[model samples]
Target: MNYFLMLSNSHADGVLSWYQTLRLEGRMCDVVLEAEGVKFPAHRTLLACSSDYFWSMFQDYTLESGAHTISLPALSSKGLEQILDFIYTSWIALSPSTLEVTLQAACYLQVTPAVDLCIEYISESIALDNCCFFANIAAHYGLSKAFTVSNSFIARSMCRILVAEQYKAELLELNLDSLQEVLAAEEMPGVKEMALLQLALDWLEYNPQSALQSNALLCRIRYSLVPPDELSRLSAIEPALCTPFIHSVVHKALNYHLQGPLQPLLQSVHTSLRTTNSKILLVGGGPEADRPQNQILAYEPRTRKFRPLSTTLPTKLQHQGVCVVGHFLFVLGGEVVKVDEESEKSAVMTVTDQVWRYDPRFDQWEEMEPLLQKRAQFTCCVVEGVIFAIGGRGQRGEPALSSVEKYTMNAGCWRSGVSLPHPVHGQACATEGTGIYISGGIYGNSPDSSKDVLFLHAFEGDAWQRRASMSIARFGHQMATVRGRIYAFLGMYEPFCDIEYYNPEQDLWTHLKPLLNDRFCYGLMATGGRRVLVFGGRKWQEGQEVCTTNVLEYDTEYDAWREVCKLPGPLCGTQCAIMTIQDPPET
Candidate 1:
């Protein structure tokens, strides 16, 4: 019988240390590695053990196996010296200035540990000045982690890198593939597509040798989004862009503007807005006691400016359910107020079952199949590509509806769905993942709003399950899901400023910071991360209801609210959605 004994990992480390000392002292060395007229003496067996390149070369079958010296002209002497030190001591020093040569030597010698070490250093050491260079090198060597980190850094810092005079040379250093990757990214914060187009054109001008790639580079631009005015300016100045390909592209964009209401039907890559171009759209709202405004206003948070789109709704609608599906905006059952022609000046508000779909691609609105039941003040949500219209009031005298209806694009028709536990109207509804949630609305014929919350696992079943109730009863309010949690904003009349959020996992509701001012019939929209925006609405002031233009933004992360900006006009009974539309020409 024999006992097995283990010498700890320190023994191996000691052996490496002893070998390193022997090589440094030029003791018992077997081979000499040379680069750039510099020679390094080392043990052949130790070099073979450390690198696959040396291991194969030292084999008996190889010409270098019998030789006492090996030449590595492709590698820098400094890089080889550093790599050899790491092989002996299990440590290496890397700096931005020498990273390229070091990584090159590691890759050339098939020293994977050193290669990974070099990659890690480059990833952590990326800076504005060297990020583009790192991206190029990592891309060249197919070093995925370094490539991804460097490209992400470049994209995030592009806004500064593009405008700063100091960074221009560095930006210009990006190769064709790297430049294309940077330009095509949608995460460039404030860098608009036009700016990217200008950058691409500048890159081409700077690198005249890349002129043959003009079409490939320029086509990444969403030409239709470049404002026809800018296109005209570019056409006049850039003789290089006057090619037939660019000319036709410009023509198509101008024609898109000409199409006006027909833009949706002619959707294309050139006409599609980047996700970064998404704006908060205030839909179908107007001054109190006035006809609902048909002209949808787009509110740009970055600029804090509002612009009304050229395309107006087919009808002025209020209390409508709005949802966006795959770039298409659907307006469901709503109250359409029109002037009573027989009564001369009086307005008649009629509940409509008509549905309309707005296609931003062409700025066109098309009437779709009517809802199964005529309802207003209902809530609609999309899940699994199907649209579900929930409880609402039907007509003027009819009681609030407990019935539900769903519409599918495949069927192209509305069908009945599972009824609500109780008829409710003026409720706030929102969806997260595959879950549909409705909370805080008046139940049937009751003047008081209910704090009850109901949920349905959409696509899984028709049953509605009761969840945690909200802190306050709300009506005509809005609900939005942000960061996987549902938030309820202020509604009408009672509990003027209370706001709350729900956590589905815990089935609980917690009060959040209330609004600075009390308002109702407003548009509530959630965008980006943990921020909810409240658009135009009506507020009670001096004993009279007055329309307000105030826009409030809530920061869930900080549990606070602040007035960011104001809407274009005082309006209420409106809905808002974040939409990617063509960018207007810059002033």
Candidate 2:
């Protein structure tokens, strides 16, 4: 009986084999596809399931009745043959010679899976020689990721591309928007600004009519980021840029030249996008559940949106300390509570030293040496390329800890550092110059034991010393640094609208403008040099408090706050940190 059952199951697994056989033999085909006046046999049900265009055609009974065969007018014969083979076999051949045509056919049929496969192929097949060819196809099919990936290849091989006679000859046909986007990218980190100017001039020489007509494209160039010397060279080459009206822009850029924090001259939409856009990462703090399934979330500043990263922490974590060391993002010690099987409810589980490091450049993660002591509700900071994890209680949340540990990238080990002056947790920490600053934390055993005392630890001194306290007590608050100044945010206590910072120079804490809403325990990150973004947190209203997805962005230079974007759900008491990932590798 078992032998017969095995035979039946094996046959069931190969049930689709009949479709492949029929497609290969051109026998019992219910539909015919005509491309370039040639016919190919296909099974209607298989084609309908594989392609939206075919599905819609089959859905209309009147259309099916009128036509026994359909003409794929936009598809080449080879492309149509490949599509039919994919519908039956779940695979199709792709190569440089046929990749573009195959992708075009798949997109026209709205076959997302095949199109995705084609995109993956394009991403893998990118090289300096064919990057523009791939980019042209990507733009035609609205494949933004493909364009971005290929552009990096083009950017890295830029010197070669600039000199390549083939690319120069084809520059005239390059899409205008694609050229603008590639040139506008602030991603050109160390490639001297002069090279970008040269590329722009090269394009202008080939297409002067468009250059003379469109200043909007010209505005996309990051003129402010360039040095005055480079601009001088540019002016010598392009006289239109130095004309009286445009020369004023050059003067503004050269004078300010993005030298100081107050250098706010360049407000062009292009520069704003290039400079301000970065990804803010969020971890844990999902729906409260028995099992505690938590994943990492990323917020793209360019899109002003939230998206979850593909990888998650080793286990569900809450109140974990996160810090960045160079290209690596480290998730330090945190607490995880799961329901006991006997009680069937949440229970005190464990304080974890489980450490996970993520490298966003490669979208990869690995386990790092765990912390010396398990902790949560702690504050972490990176000073002089070393990570310091300080003061937080163990599981069950009793007597607070004064322990501090340092994680060094070179050593890849955690060693004890000078502990905090006293037991405290839920403090906010940031590094300004060479010192690490801690402000506002809970001193007692519980969350309610909040305090406003502040402290500073200089790696030079290797000691923690008491500093001036905040005007109000806060616990579970956040801190962010902008232009060497530390900004402390309100925690879960009263005066939730106020934000204050300690002045290392004056040794005093001062309040900035109060927030638009009272918030506590939201994910906070500083980006774009002048802006601090706060994510979802709890909100108070009608004498009741509940979790909220509200987000507010504050500008330090302007001393102004405005709504940006919201998280996917309400979150509170969650830990957050900001780190910049290096751009794409030299292709």
Candidate 3:
């Protein structure tokens, strides 16, 4: 093979690069542009060669109509100058500050190259921080490709994105229709009606003049997720709820969500949330040592490979709380340093208030505001955009803590939530429907005691309420939500892979098929909403504890467990989560 890179293109490059010089010299000039208040001279051939839109315009105004002035009124003189400069240079300086104006002019003139380049830049720039603003721009200019890219990013990172200072301004200025569409978009994870209601209330605070136009937006919220206390508190003051029709609809939905309705009036309301795409994430807990492994591995389901990421936690973080909000993984507080096996000094295992977030798009870990209190060995899950950190070991290696706190992704803040009925440590938590289910945790005792209890609760209003318990007693298990069902996979040293399912409607737990062998403390998660991926942890072999490097996959639809890939190295006391990495749309 021969490579002739950039060879003999010198002559062509010279002519194309000097288009501006010739135009300024008035060489073979055929037209003049009176755009806004400034005048620009150009040759018909030069303009035609640069853009099809320009060629079409020139064709209509024949050469016989020589020296004619084309009246360009849509853009300012500066906007037109940027376009002309790009035609000559094949480049433009695009920044967050200048992108919008240039895009407007390019779209107005139907410049395909300019428009496509701008769209590509926007797609590349889409992140949790700027997704909302870019989505609004994409929607306004009818850039469907950009819209899809930005909208999906916004939908996935809705809670985190909303808390951004930039998004606050963008949301207030957004057209009512666009704002409503954002609230109503499908495929949003960990977002409940209460969060949406909070968003709506925030919008009203910013744009109070639009209170009259909010009923249409309010109707889309799932009112049943809002607890009766909060609903009653806000109804007396919130304008949208004050409206008769909207208030009645909300009250009606609230009743249906709280009570058992024989037949429901609302058919379109989504009682269940949109299922998120999944990729397996293996978090903390590796080999025990003074120097520990902070490697966080993510399984690329599409590629069928396990890859270690640089976005590991700030600490060794064993027995930490991990959950997925959109594609971002939030790891709650855990033990910062390792504890000595023989010493058993409580000072060796220091707990931290740190909360970290791993963003797949950026491939980076960011430390958010710390928790209300330092904790370790806690159970956590995202319930409609809130990270609920349930019972765990308190500071100074104390017994299980019944106190719970949740981080609100919407506001970038953490506040106290209702505490669990009993203390819990090393429990498994998962979300289905409107509630978070706690299963098989050891509360204030060793792993053998009270480890098989289960409780279901949600943010009904302000307080925590308990539901029915599971039949089997399990502790030190992993939880994953698969197709709206909560599946519990338990054991590591005592090595048992028996799985169980919790039915919210029937309020019962059913045991599923057992695994190939006994496994314990493994990192278990549901990927692609159909397959359960069990990652590495230790298992007992002939009275010897050894790490299991092999991974297992459980196909829910087929009801089978098969041995899958093996980790490069085995890890124990590790945590795991599922994050769907979004690839940019094909051109």
TM-score of each model, paired residue for residue: 0.58, 0.53, 0.51
Candidate that scores best on lDDT = 1
Ranking by lDDT: 1, 2, 3
Ranking by TM-score: 1, 2, 3
Task: For residues 9-40, write the lDDT of model 2, one tens digit per residue.
Answer: 65633756788988788788877889999998
The TM-score between candidate 1 and the true structure equals 0.58
lDDT per residue for candidate 3 within 443-474, as digits (tens), equals 67564634354454566845544545655566
Model 3 C-alpha lDDT versus the unseen true structure: 0.70
The list of candidate 2 runs beyond 4 A from truth reads 1-277, 288-293, 340-347, 444-457, 580-587
Q: Cα lDDT for residue 550, model 1?
A: 85
Question: Which whole-number lDDT from 0 to 100 does residue 421 have in model 1?
Answer: 89
lDDT, candidate 2, equals 0.71
Looking at model 2, residue 460 earns an lDDT score of: 61
- Pairs with steric clashes in candidate 2: none
What's the CA RMSD of model 1 in angstroms? 10.6
